[model samples]
Target: MENVKAVKPELEFTDYTNFEAEPIHPVEGLSQRIIAQIPGSSVATRILQFEPGTNTSPNGIQIHDFWEELYIIEGSIIDLELNEEFKAGAVACRPPGMKHGPWKSPDGCKIFEVRYYSKGQ
Candidate 1:
């Protein structure tokens, strides 16, 4: 894996105009802003906005092939896996292949996310 250069403070989250909100795949009422990424390394940072009444699924959870860490920056969301609600200031880390989230956001939410694969993946 190539080294990812450190992101300067001033360069991060400075331009929101360029980020177009798009629907999160296989999930409804969730939009995403791909903030920054390391080319060729599968490492990405993103902002996720969940519109009110969004839910991933009612049937089952979704699992990722990469590590995912997230923080609730504004508003709140419901963790279906935990059967509870998480508000701003909440944090979560999921290891590769961890089954999680069939999530819901009754009041809407905004979260910052960082994701990457394990070494050699």
Candidate 2:
């Protein structure tokens, strides 16, 4: 332990936890950002929705066989590799070790994603 006799410490307290920043810009076609804070990419997570004609950043997720559930709240998306299409009122699930991601839509789409093993889903 080092000596602390020369200077006295100051005490302070405050409570101010809120967002007061400008909202993100609305892209013409697509965009993405975190909707809430979680532990990590694979653990309990929430992401903002992007519209049709928008493209998401290419993300290669390693789920390690962890299952996942997705709710297409609005719009539609086509998984080029899977040769599958997801539209509004549609639900798609992926089994573990699926090697998923890098999704895109021709017209754009909106989706609500719930991740398991990451968010206790």
Candidate 3:
């Protein structure tokens, strides 16, 4: 068998959570942006977790004028647009100006999303 060694990332990780058990957002909701460039990561990668009854993009989602992708690392999510569903390990990409938020996951969800400003940047 071929063996592979686990290596460290170019970027370190930091926890993103609300100090309170409740969620917080505009209009009074909560979300946790766990990992990000704020922690000096290479890219603007984030571990965003939504609480039950919370919407990741509460007032309508907006994608940057660039490319963005999301991989469901844990739990489940429903894409309101096509009424399609995504589960753990499912990956989705939303291109520039895609209005794709205000979604709900009753049991909560954790997603890994990253943005690259330019090709191979």
Q: Which ten-residue region of model 1 has the weakest summed lDDT?
A: 4-13
Assess the local accuracy of residue 15 in candidate 3 as a C-alpha lDDT between 0 and 100: 46
lDDT (CA) for every model shown? Answer: 0.79, 0.51, 0.58
Output the number of the TM-score-best candidate.
1
- List candidate 2 stretches off by more than 4 Å: 1-37, 60-65, 118-121
Question: Residue-wise lDDT of candidate 3 within 24-106, one digit each (tens)?
Answer: 45623445463444233234566667665555555565555555678888887666665766788988776656677556676
Candidate 3 residues lying further than 4 Å off, grouped into runs, are: 1-10, 13-24, 27-30, 38-43, 119-121
Candidate 2 C-alpha lDDT tens digits along 1-121: 1212232223243321231222224434544333332333443223335555554444433345355677776778777566677789988687665776545688767665554442332
Q: What value of lDDT does candidate 3 attain over all alpha carbons? A: 0.58
For candidate 1, lDDT tens digit of each residue in 6-120? 5422354376548888787767788898777666555778899999998878436877677889999998988788998999999999887788877898989999999876576
Q: In what order do the candidates fall by TM-score, top score first?
A: 1, 3, 2
lDDT of 1 at 47: 90
Better of 2 and 3 by TM-score: 3
